[model samples]
Target: MELTRLKKKLVTAVKGHKLLKDKRDELMRQFLDLVRENMALRQKVEAGILSANKNFVIAKAGMSEQILNTALMSPKQEVYLEAGKKNVMSVDIPVFETKTRTADANDVYSYGFAFTSGDLDGAVKSLADILPDMLRLAEVEKSCQLMASEIEKTRRRVNALEHVIIPETQQNIKYITMKLDENERSTQIRLMKVKDMMLEEAHHYKEKEVMVE
Candidate 1:
């Protein structure tokens, strides 16, 4: 009976150890995936930032030139911004579209310039041109944040399984296995002693029968 109990305990411990190992492996996979995603997003964010900077420089130079030229020509113009929404990776970014109008209070100064004559136009155009970059940056930033959060959560889970939960379960399994082993040894010793006593008694009976004969 004791041997039977030990066998059952050993089986249970082996099963529990396998389950804990599987859980640890699964958590590690999840954590690795999140890390990969975070690295990709970071790369994209860097590229987008560089592109945004280049666009800003070009836009600044163009606007400066346009401002000087417009001032010299003394042309009057009005510009308005109409912005629309652009969705990138579930993040909505504003894309400003420009509308320019030229109005002459009197015919003293005739407006003979392109829609891209003024600083405001240049600024608006620059903004519109960089809208895609802005959107990319937003998407990358948000994705990075989300990935980082998920990675942290996954890491914690992995740590718990690897360091605390799995180890505790394995320790318990070891303890149970040891107990079962000890019980089995004790039972085997008891059985051997019982068999030896039975053999001695049988020999004594044979001796008595011989003496009577």
Candidate 2:
């Protein structure tokens, strides 16, 4: 009975190991995709920031510091961000949403267009255009981080199941089977001895009765 139970447990462990392995593989694939996306987004974000900075520098150089500061003093835009989560392979990954409210194109330039250099407008527009991409980059990067962590955890579980639980369960089953076999052999030997003694006793009784007759 113990041996049968142990075999059942071994089967369960093996099945569980397979499932964990599959999950790990899927997680790894997702992780790699997220990594590639992160790399590309990082590059694009870096380039956008650099270009915007260069434009800002040119605008600053072309205009007085006071005028530039005045132009940027009053903001006509507001941004709202919401964060949530989505499930992937039993792992929860964060989702980010961005909502932007701008007064109007007319109000984007706080100061007169004549007072501000075209470079400033270019810089502002470029930054504005990249805002959504920047948010996307942030979301992707964070998801990559989370997915990497989950993958590592899943790998550890898979390794443990493969190396430890399944092997140990199999070993237990083997041990129980060996013990049961030995017990069966011992019982057979005892039964054979009893049968031989019974036959000898019957033969002795028959000889005594014949001699009496």
Return the TM-score for each candidate structure.
0.51, 0.94
Candidate of highest lDDT: 2
- The residue-by-residue lDDT of candidate 2 on 1-213, one tens digit each, is 788888888888888889989998998889888888889888888888899999999999999999999999987777789999999998888888876676453345556787899999988877877777798888888888888888888888889888998888888888888888999999999999999999999999999999999
Estimate the Cα RMSD of every predicted model relative to the unseen true structure.
10.6, 1.7
| Pairs that collide, model 2 | none
lDDT (10s digit) by residue, model 1, range 64-131: 66654554366444446575765432334445565446443232223333533444344334444444
Candidate with the greatest TM-score versus the true structure: 2
**Candidate 2 local lDDT, residue 210:** 100
Worst 10 residues of 1 by lDDT: 104-113
Clashing pairs in 1: none
